[model samples]
Target: MRQEKLKYLAKLALLVLMGIFGSFLISEAGLRLMNISYPVFHGFDPVRGRILEPGMEGWFRYEGNAYVKINSAGFRDVEHPLQKPKGTYRILLLGDSYTEARQVSLENTFGRKVEQQLQSCERLLPHLVEVINFGVPGYGNAEELITLRSRGWAYDPDLVLTMFFSGNDLIDNFPRAELREPAYIPRPYFHLDQGELKLAYNFQEWSPPILKYRLLLWGVHNFRTLELLNQANRVLAARHIGDSQENLSSRAGLADFVYAPPQTPIHREAWDITEGILKLMHQEVLKHGANFFLVTATSPDQIDQEERILLKERLATKKLDYPEQRLRALGEIEGFPVLNLLYDFQQYAEQHPAHLHGFSNTKLGAGHWNEQGHELAAQLISKRICQDPSIL
Candidate 1:
């Protein structure tokens, strides 16, 4: 009787396992059939640190619902030939997430908008213009320098545009030791040694196992079910840990340091490193025979009147525009043209009276640029390029 009971239990267990496996397969097939996928687009790169997963496509519905595709070159933009076709004027864009502009659709991104607008320019009427996006989220100038060296120059672009985001690029360039708070993602940093710039791999050296990263990436890439679960987990984690930067307090903390002048020794060092990196980038672009331009991205606090007032009241300073001023000054000194979008963005916001930075799902005027912001940015950038005969 005991043997019979054991056999029955074994049969039941087998049936349960089979049922679960069948259910998983069904769910996976159903998701695939419905063409639904979660955005798991980032992949680890030993050189650049983090890059968009090549040939990855999914529905980005976190901040806004839009389908995103990463070309086989790992750029968020459309595919292009590596060898520049004859009579083609290619522009390579390097920056952090602002250049990536994943919050909106690819067509709505400033890069695409700039490309579309420039197509009608009479200066280069016959030559086809292509703008390749080499932006990655959470990247600082350090990574951008590496990317320009390793990947960007290969395109043989006629112009290289670096979109500098003061919000975190200023803070993210320094070594982890100099930072007051630990960086959420470890990254390579550039440090000056005897007035020479050197790459420090402290972040990579101290990071967790690469195998773990590879496995997670593989799972997300191959399994739609895993992708959904991974996104859900991230959302849950953000909620539980209060990690989203959409809150007023978080923005205030960031603004206090970034919006103001370098108050501490670390802040000063960070600025030095940032400027050094930019200079190096300029030199490299010149060496490659391409014109370089730096554009400072607008911060929400810099545009939002209410947020600006609140920040000024909190920080006890009216000099919230220090970051843009520093970048403009740097461009002037370094002989590169700078299009400071802060003033224009501010003017647009005051006139139009709409949110440029954030969406309805997230706090308005607190995060990445919305569609209107990108549209305005494209207008300004294209106008600058068209007006400047040197770039042509």
Candidate 2:
């Protein structure tokens, strides 16, 4: 009877080992087949010590982080950590993907434009201006504010400009839903407790294994899964809009392209969330003794209203939903001095019709700014800053 029991125990142990090996093989195969790349998720490298060198206008992996590169005219990475420069009025700009310049080169980014404009103005004004871009992709206002308070305050910025993109910034800030994949780490939100704002995540005190698991899951699922899902959704949405194979191929041409706005009010949560985010951002900016300037980034539809309406009707005929004026109204509130780039770009497009080229050159591609768009935005922002010296 003892011999029989020993044999049975050995058989159970063998089966368990086999199961573990099988799972490993399956997971390895999936990783190999996926051909996943770096910057898989945010916080994979929470400390911003690593720097990616300049490269061509395509995706590149650097230090295990994936980044899209652009060859903008005069863009360079600030290699050293941000420190307060004496005798200079520094300006820190923060926002999400749009501010991050996803599709545009660094030189063509609004941050660069603002910097150039400020440098030019320095000739006339005695005080010199230095603008730093603290923009990160997939970040919400909460992240921006947190970054400003934690990382950015050390730079001693006189003014903090937060560009608010109305579409997804709100959804990006929602509580659990805000927890993005590893490539895009969501900034922690702080609640006021006992008259003091505490750190949201206790990184120092957390267990290493738990943090690693969280980071790994974020890297694998958030960065990889969601990206694939978004591409699939866009394709499906395009099909629902009855786009032809040729039209789909020319999606790049429609860089300013937008699908039919969703009819459900559920999508409108972006508005409320953005407002709340702005309020939080304002408080954070004030805490740092820096003024906050809110810039309203324009949507493609806002630039071409009639064309967007026609597209909306076309999608509606196909029984597809889309966002409408309710989304636009989110920007019209009278709290801060808002720079409406949508109207400015529309007017510019009217004057320079040739500016509306394919996806690579258009201003309407997912809130990214082309060179001309950045130039215009910089000019407008400069004018506003000059007009309101108090904000400075």
> TM-score of every model?
0.88, 0.60
Misplaced by over 4 Å in model 2 are: 1-76, 122-124, 176-270, 304-307, 311-335, 355-358, 361-367
Instruction: Give one digit per residue, the lDDT tens place, for model 2 in 1-392.
Output: 99999999999999999998787666556644877433222232242211122332233222111245422211133432457656777888887766766455566667777777776663336776777777766666666766666677777888888886654554454433322223233245443345344435423223574475455545443344444444456557655553443343242222112234433433334334445667666767777788878777765544554655665575554311122233334334534455556666667777776442114422333235555666777888887787675576
Candidate 1 weakest lDDT stretch, 10 residues: 246-255
Give me the displacement of residue 111 in model 1, in angstroms.
0.9
Error of 2 at 16 (Å): 21
Clashes of each: 0, 19
Local distance difference test scores for all models: 0.83, 0.54
Off by over 4 Å in 1: 1-23, 177-186, 203-208, 240-255
lDDT of 1 by residue, 81-120 (tens): 8899998889999988899888899999999999999998
